[model samples]
Target: MEQFSTMFLSFIDTWGYVAVAVLMGLENACIPIPSELILGFAGYLISAGRMEFFHATVAGMIGGMVGSIVTYYVGSHGGRPFIDRYGKYFFMKKSHVDTAQRWFDKYGVKAVFFSRILPVVRTFISLPAGFARVNMKKFIIYTFLGSLPWTMFILYIGWLLGDNWKSMLAVGHEASLIVATLIVLICLFYFIRYKRNKKRL
Candidate 1:
């Protein structure tokens, strides 16, 4: 883990925005790169006067769009059978896929926009949107809107914390994980309740 972190930090230090873009893209593409780490480090750099926050956010947004586009294309072309076969390896299940599909169907492009602000949900939301054959232009626009704010917030937090940022980041990570887990549990509870209600009807 330390070696990987070192390599990742090296990549970010050397390549700057390009590394951020690729990392964000990969995070969206179901690779395990942490978008939090990328944005936070970028924020640290900005605080150190090494880069502009707006530019960092823009780079992150672009990376997010590109990564999501790749997933969308794969899901669109690969279809359900492919998702069912390969998704499990990535810790995704058919039920989760179906849930995302239903959300997209019910909410249209807004689902894409909102999901980008979520933690784990953000990673897989694009798959169902792609599979549902959502409008590409709308997907891009909503994704940017949703992701830009999130990217900016994390980066800004890092900038404000400066050299003491790592300690703040550790606290933030713990908080984010707790919040993400709670959201997942809440969503699951509601999904189960909705299913039971529908069955009775």
Candidate 2:
């Protein structure tokens, strides 16, 4: 842990603010960089007097927003055909994407707003929203609103936890798994009931 802290601090010393922006942006861009560590590292920097709180927060938000815009455009322009051809590399299947699209359609802007804070959902919600051709202006607005609090909260964690930041990431990952499992179970139950009702009819 001490070695990691040293290496990370070294990174901050070398790249400064741009590294924060780029890492956070890639996280949103589906590159699998965990925001927990990304923002946490920034927070640690702040606590160590190497970074400013406002600068780190703003950079994180800006980086995340930029990455989200890129994802939104990819979903909007490429559409399903692109996904059908290449999404498997990302472990995405058509039915899953279709389900997300339906949910987004039913919920509209609220889906995008909430998805920004919901674990893995935050990572891919833009795809279905883009496929549905949601308004770009509204999408950006809700995404920013959703991302702001998440950024602030996670950055706070990093600042607070300091050397123990890695542990928080583990806990977050496990929590995401639990939430995902619950969602799957709920969906499965709903599907079974719907099918049974159809048979009765």
The local lDDT score (0 to 100) that residue 104 gets in candidate 2 is 80
lDDT digits (tens) for residues 49-95 of candidate 2: 88888999899899999988887888889997998898878656566
Which residue runs of candidate 2 sit more than 4 Å off their true CA positions?
A: 1-13, 88-103, 173-201
Q: Write the per-residue lDDT of candidate 1 for residues 118-180, one digit (tens) a residue.
A: 656677788888888889999888888767667877788789877766655466556355444
Query: Which ten-residue region of model 1 has the weakest summed lDDT?
Result: 174-183
Model 2 gets an lDDT of 0.77
Candidate 2 C-alpha error for residue 94, in Å: 6.8
Q: Which structure among the candidates has the greatest TM-score? A: 1
The lDDT for every candidate, in the order shown, is: 0.79, 0.77
TM-score list, all predictions: 0.77, 0.75
- What's the number of clashes in each of the models? 0, 0
